[model samples]
Target: MSTVVVTGGTGTAGRAVVNALVAAHHDVVVTSRSTSSVHGRVRTVRLDYGSPADLEAAFHGPDAVVHCATSFTGVRGGETELGRRVLAGARRVGCGHVVSISIVGIDRIPLPYYRAKLATEKLVENSGVPWTILRATQFHELVTRLLSGLTRPPLVLVPDIPVQPVAAEEVGARLAALAAARPAGRVPDLGGPEITTLPALARSYVAAIGRRRRVRAVRLFGSVFAGYHAGHHLAPGDATGTITYQDHLDAWVRTRR
Candidate 1:
């Protein structure tokens, strides 16, 4: 069996990828700073990208590496550093393929986070390691988290951010498939079924949770503008996912209930 190493395996998308790989009969090794949050049949290792030694040790004997680890809230400098460390470790261990998860419209959105993601993509391409990059749209869980508390009080200030919500499960499946295939420069974008707005999403979430909160759509110009002006940071054309936002909401509600 081929061994697959997944970075950030404790996270939402990373965990899903680990699950998918294990279910497909692949040997999965998960690495992250914190292993307490991860649960499954796969092996777990303690890792910190800050330490190249730890990273090298994790990469040892892995057939492929799924690079889902990211520090999205920071500027580009730190991400660049971490990307370099990851590439070095991958090379040291002679990993066959590296599959990276990135965001759509990173070129169009000039935010620090997107800039870092774009730079990492370039770094991966130039690392001399065969690689496949997948740029996916926003996750429905991320959107729901952002809108969770917005429906409080008298008025809810909703930014006009355009978003095409994607199910994390679909993205996870695609990532696993990419890891199992030959390296492609960049894969097609993955997005949800329909285009949606921030306010509409907030209302749907409030209803889903059976909350009696009222959400008023108030237009605001914030960092969301940078994310919104590019059409909600969504990929163009029809890259429809099998799961819908409503479907995601129903699932989340069922779990909570």
Candidate 2:
């Protein structure tokens, strides 16, 4: 089995990827800022992009590296710097293949986060290491969290935008498979099983939690929201994900019971 290193292994998508790689019997090494919170049979390492030694150690001697690390809450150049360090480390270790996870419509979306993701994708393309970039739509959990936070008392205000939210586990599995295969520059974008409106998603989340909240659709006046509302962020013909939003809510409700 190939030695595979997964960055950001403690995060939602990264954790699922690590589990899948371990199940496949690949020599999997996971990295995080701290290993104290990491569980399971996988090996864990501390990763800090600011420290070149840490980056070099994390990517050392890996046949393949799955880069899932991203910092959305940090400074403006955090994501770009992280991507650079990952590529540099992979190059240092002579990694054969590098698989990266990105968002669908990052090129079309004008939001700063999407722009940063797109910039990172560009880095992988020119990193000289064989790479596969998988661009997926929003995750069901992210949508649920966003809606939950927007639920102010009795009214849940949701932006009127179309979204195709995929399951993180499904995306993780896809990433693991890609990491095992030959690098294919950019694969077909993965999307949810169905196209849904944000308001519909909010209502489903409210009903799942047994919250008596009124869902109201709001038109957000911004370039970012306009792009989303125009369906630029959706993958209509590329709905590869089988799990629907309702399925996500049902599973979540079962977990809470």
Candidate 3:
């Protein structure tokens, strides 16, 4: 039986990947800083990506490894370091393929997190190990939250930006498929069915949830605005998602209602 190791099994995207891989009858092992809600046919391995020793042990003997961990609170070099450590461990253990999930528009976004993600991609490519770099758009849930606190005095000040967000579940399925196959350097970018602007998305979300709030689109006028207008944060035309934003939003509303 081929075994696949998931590095961020507790995250939104990683959990979905684990479930998809397990459903396909693959032996799956998950590694995280702490234990997750483990399911049947999934074994949890405790690992902190910064520590090479733990990474080496968890990565050893796996057929393929999927790296989905993100260092949110650490220093600027944290994500890059994690990627380096994971790749080093994978190569040492003779793992065949490594699939990494990355953000779209990371190179031109100029955000600290995006910069780290971009650096990590280069790290994986130069690691001398077979790898797949899957760049995906924002998740629907993330966009929803960004809109949550924007209402102020009957006006919603959402930054003007384009987005094609995909559901977390779809991304997970794609990652599992990538892990089970050979490295595809840079795969087609994945995004939602329709492109929606940030302000419009916020309005739609507010309306759907019966918030009775008026969403007022505002132009961004700073480094952040420059990134927003540059369209560096959106996926290109070649890659599109099967699920629509409306479908995701409706489902999300149902879950909360």
- Tell me, by TM-score, which candidate is best: 2
Residue-level lDDT of model 2, residues 46-111, one tens digit each, is 777778898888788888999998988433668877898889989987899999999988888787
Error of 1 at 157 (Å): 1.5
Report the Cα lDDT for candidate 2. 0.87
**Global lDDT of each candidate:** 0.83, 0.87, 0.83
- Candidate 3 off by > 4 Å: 36-38, 73-77
My TM-score estimates for the predictions, one after another, are 0.92, 0.95, 0.93
Report the number of the highest-lDDT candidate.
Answer: 2
Q: On lDDT, who's better, 2 or 3?
A: 2
- Model 2, TM vs. native: 0.95
For candidate 1, lDDT tens digit of each residue in 11-41? 8899889878988888888887876333455
lDDT of 3: 0.83
Worst 10 residues of 2 by lDDT: 34-43
